[model samples]
Target chain A: MRHTISVLVENKFGVLSRISGLFSGRGYNIESLSVGETIDPAVSIMTIVTTGEDLVIEQITKQLNKLIDVIKVVDFLEIDHVEREMILVKVAPRKEDKPEVLQLAEIFRGRIVDSGQTTYTIEITGEEKKISAFIDLIKPFGIKEFVRTGKVALAREGTRKGK
Target chain B: MKISGAEILVECLKKEGVKHIFGYPGGVVLNIFDVLYDEKDLQLILTRHEQGAIHAADGYARASGKVGVAIVTSGPGATNTVTGIATASMDSIPLVVFSGQVPTLLIGNDAFQEADIVGITRPCTKHNYLVKDIKDLAQTVREAFYIASTGRPGPVLIDLPKDVTAGMSDFVWPQEVKIRSYNPTYHGNKYMINQAAQMIAHSKKPVIMAGGGVILSGASKELRELAEFAKIPVTMTLMGLGGFPGTHKLSMGMLGMHGTYYANTAVQNSDLLMGIGVRFDDRVTGKTEAFASHAKIMQIDIDPTSIKKNVRVDLPVVGDVKNVLRDLLKTLKEIKEQQWGAVRSAWLKQVERWKEERPLTYRFDKNIIKPEFVVEKIYEVTKGEAIICTEVGQNQMWSAQFFKYDHPRRFLSSGGLGTMGYGFPAAIGAQLACPDKIVIDIAGDGSIQMNIQELATAVINKLPVKVAILNNGYLGMVRQWQELFFKERYSHTHLESGNPDFVKVAEAYGAVGLRATKPEEVEPVLKEALKVKNRPVFMDFVVDWKEKVFPMVPAGAAIDQMIFDEEKEEKKLKAVK
Candidate 1:
């Protein structure tokens, strides 16, 4: 099962690599990972999306806690959570189909970031399902380029998981 | 005054009260060694290999109940410590290993002698660090020692970059460590303790299984008190051999795969089984579903993850064994002792019947020496006074089975990792830790050859560690498995051709050498080896190659389903009566 996990760790050198090494070395599957500085600059919060059963998940969490730099680990499955992913797609636009593509972008609340004579670069941010729905509608127009920031998550306030 | 990272490293070690370091010097760590030239307080024992150094530290940790320390250089030096790290990890021995790394600027550039040690050791180490800056060095060291010695003690590593060691920074000693997420619960939950005490007070058939945690927590006194107070029979895991007195009437000896038949059978029939500090590894549990089938199992452990990870724990209490056992005793006092009377006596009589039915037995031939007989002789010669370390496989089991360990920290071995060539160097460290005690390594021919190079370290340092090599002409454990389960193919397990003349090898290292080929010669050889006060003596005994460890339980077999030599089993039972 795919679950999002948040790990708070000290902002020290090589901690990221160590965490990633743990996953790869132990044969745990990693779907997506995103890390950034937290409210305290001396620490960082990382959001990881992974798939595993109860035993595997328990092992991963316990082992991560054993790491000195790791401050806390929380699985979003046990609490209420919000997840987001962002994507950028460059779609080929025909002279006649340009209006339809613009209307589709407006309906999804996506912005056209860059444009050329034959291509329109559209940017969108939402939950994974919404981003996938937007992609499904635009793929027929010939996607020239595609990129995405992997899923990041936040647990709702007053859950397992907040100070 | 400004201090370099190297000076800070040594100073912090001194502050930690570390008296000895076991390691080998190399390219990246040369700068750190250069600063050691003027040091007079700490002694550095140079080992032949990085693996040897780490195993020595592990031995020191086990023998002294202190955090063992080691330092090694980068690349191959760091990689060689992996086996030792995993060994210490498996057994929960406290150790701190420091490895020299390439300079910070050259780390990822593939510079000379560079490796991502932190990446390699992530899975094995309890915690590890790579210091990219000089300022974080001191606090990191302090944290490493703290994490290594506290709460299910295990190994921790610090990767020191060359540039960081050469760079200067003002050192600030970390005062109090307050890790918000890393707190270990010392006292168990009061509710759980009361529940356990109530069960113990009412149990008609109760057994206590003690483990390595008893020794690691220094809770031997508490464990003994609880056992005697409740009139309970106690059995120990391989790692927990010395945690409870082996000579006590209530002691059931080692339990599990090669465990005594009485211990295994009693556990299977018990009504209340209390497992203290045991993880219930597959070897211990055998067939998990059938293990303790008649019992309600309770567990006390510091690691919450360990409780019920494999076995179904009925009453799980998360706390250090010492504190939990202490709390249980106190709560047990609150409840009035029950009058089990005939019920408890009948259970004890049944357990005694099991012991008399199948005692640990082996008949030695006058013409040929048996490894079991040799181990028994070593025990008699030492009068159960020597510190016993062992190599893996048949030798280790025989040592665990025959030689009784009555005190905590008296028996040390590579229990978890089962590393070959661990016994000799670890014996060196054990000798260094307890200078007055006699240290002996019970070894197999194939295993002793793995680290025989350490003989120089023993001779030069005048460490009088003894080696008792049981020469069975093959990797006896694997060979025994093949004979029993694989139709006796014996494929590649033979080591007779590559085996060395161990007696001569010991003499060449400026140590005494002795050999025993007949059963009558075992006692004399061991006595001679024990008397060598200033130097090590390696004793090689040629035993029957086809002999195997008895009372065997194949993998996945239930704990009670042990297979013994059919004829010997009947004869031994009759002989005992």
Candidate 2:
């Protein structure tokens, strides 16, 4: 099963490397990871997408908590949570297919973040399935470049019981 | 007062109550060594190799229950300590290692003697730091010590750049360390403790499997009390050898791949197995599905990650071993009547029968010396009072099986990493930690030579550490495996042609040298070596190379399925008994 885990850690040097090193060292597969400073500048929140069995996921969370820099780890699987992933896709389309691409992007609620003479860089943000659907619809027009901002997650306020 | 970073480091050490530092000086660490030159309180014992220095520090920590300190230069010097650090980390020994780095400017520029030590040690260390600024030096040292010594203790490394040491800063000792992200739970949950106590109360054939955590937590007293009060027979992992009195009737000696037959049987047939301070290492739990299959497993550990990492744990109480054990005992006492009286007695009797039937024994040869005999002699001569360290392989197994460790920290070895050269330097450190106690290293011929240069360190310091080399002329453990499973090919395990005369080597280093070539001579050599009071003594005992440790559980096999030594299986179990 895939788990989206949010870890709050001390915003210090090498904290990212430490977390990544931990995952690699323990042979845990990390599908994607993204980090950014939280409201408190001294702390940072990292979202990691990893797949493992229930036992492995438990170990992963426990191990993360063991690190000195890590403050908290919340796995979205246990409680009500929301997750989003953003992807930017640059598509090169024939002049005749431009209208169809624009219509598909509008239908999926995507925006054109950048434009080139023959390319349209569309930005899409949603759950994994929505992003995948947008990419599939845009693949008809050659995708020149692509990038994704992994997944970011947060637990629902009322559903979070205890640390 | 304004002082150099090196000076601040020294002050931090002084404040931390560190008296001895096991280290080797090199290029970048010279500033720190310079500070130690005129220092009066802290003594720096220079070792020949960085690995030796780190292992010595580890031994000191294990013996003293304090954070062991080691310092080395960057690049090769820092890299050499990796094995030692990993050894400590795996066994949860508390150690703080300082490795000097190239100047901060040269850190990632690939300058001379520069290495990203913090990055290299990240996976192995409990925590590590790279002091990029002088202002962080003292605080980093304080944090390093704090992290290394607290809950589920392990080695922590502080990589100090040369420029940081040379940089000037005002030194202020931190009175207390508070890391927002790190707070260890000291007390077990009341409900979980109650559940565990109930399980113990209801258990019929209960066995307590203790590990290094017991010793690390200083919980031996509480563990013994719990076992005795509950009438639970105890089996110890290799690292847990001394956590309980080895001579006690309820004690089932070291359990694992080379564990005693009765320990394995009791664990398999157990109705309840309470794992106190143990991680249920793979060696201890061969074929996890079959291990303690009949029992409801309960694990008490300080590290939450260790509880269910391997086997299925029915009840887990995450807290300090000492604290949890005390709570469990208190809760057990609250019960109105104990229903385990007759059932527990019968269980113990059955375990006793298994012990008597298949005791740990090696065939006694009157003419040819057996390595096991050498360990027995060391145990007898020391009267079980010496601090015993061991090199990896057959010598270590024999030492664990024959010698009785009656107290925590009495027996120290590389249980997790199984480093070959660990014992000699560790013995040196153990001797320094417990200056009045006799410290001995039961080593193999293959392993003692790995760090034999430390003989000079011992001779210079006047540490009378005895090194008993079980000279089997082969890497006996590897040879045994090859013989049993690999068709007796004996590929590269033999060490006869390249081996040095250890006695001569000892003499060259200004230490006493003794040799025993026959079975009758073993005790005499050991006795003579024990008489040496001013320098280390190397006692080389030529033993039967063909002897193998048994009853052995082959890899992936259930613990109950053991292959005993053909020569000793049916014999009367009178040898080590």
Candidate 3:
């Protein structure tokens, strides 16, 4: 099972390496990780996706909480949460397939971030499943290159148990 | 007041009440050493190597219950402390190591003598800091000590850049350091304590398993009280040797691989197990699924990760062992009379039968010295009052089995990492920590040579630390494995051809050296070594080469399925071979 964990940490240097090093050291692989400053400039939030058994995931969360710089660790597994991943896909489409590609991007609510004589860069932000579906539809048009900002998640208000 | 970063560091150490620092000076740490030259309060002892310095600091921490401090320069000096740092980290020993780094400007330029020590030590250290500015020096030092000594205590490293030490700033020390994210729960949960207490009171066949945390938290008294009140037998891990009285009737000695047969059998047959401050490492658990298979286990530890890490538990209490034990004991006090003599009589009798049937024993030889006999002789001569440290391998196992550790912190060894060269310098640190007490390092022939250079440090400091070298002419533990599991192919395990004379080596460093090649000479050699109170002594005991630690559980086997000595289970040994 994959768990999307949100960790709030002190916005200090080497915090990323400390976290990443911890994951690697424990033989836990990060499927996706994204970090950015939160509302408080001194704090940063990291959303990490990792796969493990329930027992291992519990250990992972506990170990994450053990690091001094880490402020909070929340596994979005049980809470009602919102997750989004953004990907910029550059595609080279033949003239006949250009209409189909534009229609597919429109259906996915993607915007053409950039355009070239031979390629189009479309930006899409959505749940992982939606992004994967969009990429699958766009694959027929010949993807030239792509970059993704891994998943970032936030728990919905009042969804947490007992609150 | 304004002061240089080096002076601020010194002031911080003084504030922390540090009496001695085990360190090795190098190019990058010259500024700090120069500042210390005129310092009056803090004494700096230069060791032969960085590894020795760190291990000595670890031993001091284990003995004194204070955060051990070590300082070394960058590159090779910093790298050399890796093994020692890992050893301390694995054992949950509190240590703060200061490694000198190149100037901040050259940190990433790969300058001469520069190493990214903070990055290198990230996976091992509980936390680390690379001080980029002088302003953060004092605060960083304070936080490093705080983090190193709190919660599940472990080693913390502060990489000090040369320029940072030279930079000047206000020497303001933080009165208190607090990390919002780092609060440790000293008290266990109320409901969990109640549940645990209820289970303990109702259990008829309960066994208490203690580990290093009991010793670390100084909870041995509480542990003993609980065991006695509940009529529970106690079994200790290697690190937990001194957490309970080894000679107590209820004490089942150590459990798991190389553990006493009675202790392992008790655990396997147990109906309830209260694991206090234990992590259930594989060496203790054998096959996790089969370990304590018939028992309901309740694990208590300060580190939450340690709970259910290797084996699932029926109840988990995450808190300091001392605090949790206090609560559990209080809760149990509510139960009237609290004595289990009648309820647990049958179980205790069965355990006693096992102990009598297969007590820990090694065959005696009149012509040649046996390592176990040597350990026994040392115990008798010292009257079990000396603090014992050990190098890894057969010597360590023998020491654990024979020498009874009756108090917490009396036995300090590399239990977690099992580092080979840890004992000698560790003994030096333990001796320095308690000047009036005796310290001994039970060492193997192969392990003593690892940090043998520390003899000079011991001699220079006039620490009367004793080193008992069990010279078995081979890496006895590995040889035993090869002999039993791999068809007796000695391969490279033999060391007799290149072995140096340890007595001469000790004498060369101005320390007393004695060699006992015969069984009858062991007692005299130990007594002669004990008479030297001003200088370190090394007693090289030439022992039987083929003797192996018994009650051995092969890797992946159940704890109860153990192979004993040839005299007791010759058929089992032959079957495994």
Candidate 4:
């Protein structure tokens, strides 16, 4: 099973390495990780996606919470939550396929962030499943370069449990 | 109060109530060392190696229940602390390690003696910092100590750059350090505590598995009370050796790989297992699938993750060990008339039979001194009063099996990392914690050589820490493996030809050296070593090199399916050869 864990930690030096190092030490690999300062500037939020069994995921969350710098760990699966992911994809469309690509972008509610003679960089921000579906459609147009921000989530009512 | 970062660092250490620091100086830490030259209240003990300093600090923390402090230089100096940091983290020993880094401006550049100490130590340390600004130095130091010593205590690193130490800053001591996201649950769920009490009140076969957390939380008394009141047998992990009285009749002795047969059986047959402060490590649980199969386990620990990390439990009580035990005792008060001890008589009788049927034993042929015999004699000589530390491998097992601990914090070993050279330096650190108490390092020839240079540190400090070397002439544990599993292909396990005379080496380091080659010499050597005060003594005992530890559980085997003798295996190997 894949678990998306939102880890809020003190925005101190080497904290990212600490979080990532913990995973590596435990022999767990992070599928995707996106880090940025949270609403509290003193703290940083790390949205990490990792695949593991129920037990392994539990250990990961518990160990993350054990870290002194870490403020809170929220697993999206535990409660009603909203998950969002963003991706910027540069698609090299053939002259004939350009119209199809634009129509697909419009259908997905994506924007053309950049445009060149042969490539159009499209940006999409939505739920994780929607972005994945959008990428599947864009891949047919020949994706030249693509990158994504891993899923970040918030509980529906900011409810806390098992603290 | 304006002061340099170096001065602020020293001041913060003083404010943290640090009386002693175990460290070594280097180029990157010159500024800090320069400031230390004038500090009168703080005592600095220079160790031969950075690893030794860290181990010593670890030992100090384990013994005194205070956060140990270690300071090392940058690059190689910081690199050397990696093993010690891991060892401390695994054991949950509180430690604050200060590593000197290159100036902030040249941190990423390949400057002279510069290393990313914070990056290197990130995983091993509970938390780490690479302070670039002088203003953050004071608060960082305070936070380092606070985080290291609190909750599930572990090592924390603070990387100090040379320029930051030289820079000026206002030295303001933070009155209280707080982390918004870090709050430890001190009380276990009350409903669960009552349920556990009710379960224990009815359990026909009950057991208590205690670990180092009992010692860390100073809950040994509470644990003993709970076990006695509930009439449950007690077993311990390697790190939990002294958490309960090994000499007590209800004590099942150490459990798991090198554990007593009776202890393992009791756990397998247990109806209710109240695990106090133990992580249920692989060594203790053996095959987790088959471990305590009949028991409805209730795990009590401060670290929530430890509860189900290795094995699942029926009930989970998350809190500090002392607090949980105290609450448990109170919950059990209502069932005082039940007399749980009277109900579990039959189970206790069964355990006693198991203890008598297959006790830990060794035969002394008199032709050669057995390693187990040496440990047995050391125990007799010490009267179980000494704080015993051990280097990893066979000697460690022998000590755990032969020398019983009847008090808390009396037995120390690198349970998690199993660092080979941990014992000697750790002994010195333990000695420093209890100046009037006798401290000894039970060692093997192979592991002792790992940090033999610490003899200089021990001698100069005049710590009467004794080192009892079980000189088996081979990496006995590895040799045993090759003989049993690989048809006696010794490989590089033999250290006979290249080995130096241990006594002579000890003498060279300005320490008292003694050798006991015969079985009768064991008692005399131990007595003489004990007599020498303010001077460390190294006693080397030449034991049967081929003698292997018994009651061994083969790799990947269930704990219950242990091989009790070596003769059968050796005979089988001979047929193959």
The top-ranked prediction according to DockQ is: 2
In model 2, the runs with Cα more than 4 Å from the true position are A160-163, B570-577
How many residue pairs clash (N, CA or C atoms closer than 3 angstroms) in each of the candidate models, in the order given?
Answer: 0, 0, 0, 1
* After superposition, candidate 3 runs with Cα above 4 Å error: A161-163, B568-577
Name the candidate, 1 or 4, with the larger DockQ value. 4
The reply for model 4, stretches above 4 Å from the true place, is A157-163, B566-577
Candidate 1's DockQ: 0.44
Which pairs of residues collide in model 2? none
After the best TM-score superposition of candidate 1, give how far the Cα of residue B347 lies from its true spot, in angstroms. 2.6
**Model 3 steric clash pairs:** none
Judged by TM-score relative to the true structure, which candidate is superior, 1 or 3? 3
TM-scores of chain A in all candidate models: 0.91, 0.96, 0.97, 0.93
Model 1 superposed RMSD (Cα): 2.6
**Tens-digit lDDT string for candidate 4 (B482-521):** 9989999999999978889999999998899999988888
Residue by residue across B85-188, what tens digits does model 3's lDDT show? 99999999999999999998888998888888899889889999999889889889999999999899999999999999888889998999998989988999
The TM-score obtained for chain B of candidate 2 when compared with the true chain B = 0.98
The fnat score for candidate 4 comes to 0.96
Tell me the RMSD of model 3 versus the true structure: 2.1
Consecutive 10-residue window with the lowest summed lDDT within model 1 chain B: B336-345
DockQ of all candidate complexes? 0.44, 0.93, 0.87, 0.78
- Worst lDDT run of 10 residues, candidate 4 chain A, spans A154-163
What TM-score, over all chains together, does every model reach?
0.94, 0.98, 0.98, 0.96
> Candidate 4, after superposition: displacement of residue B102 in Å?
1.3
Error of 4 at A85 (Å): 2.6
Cα error, candidate 4, residue B345 (Å): 0.6
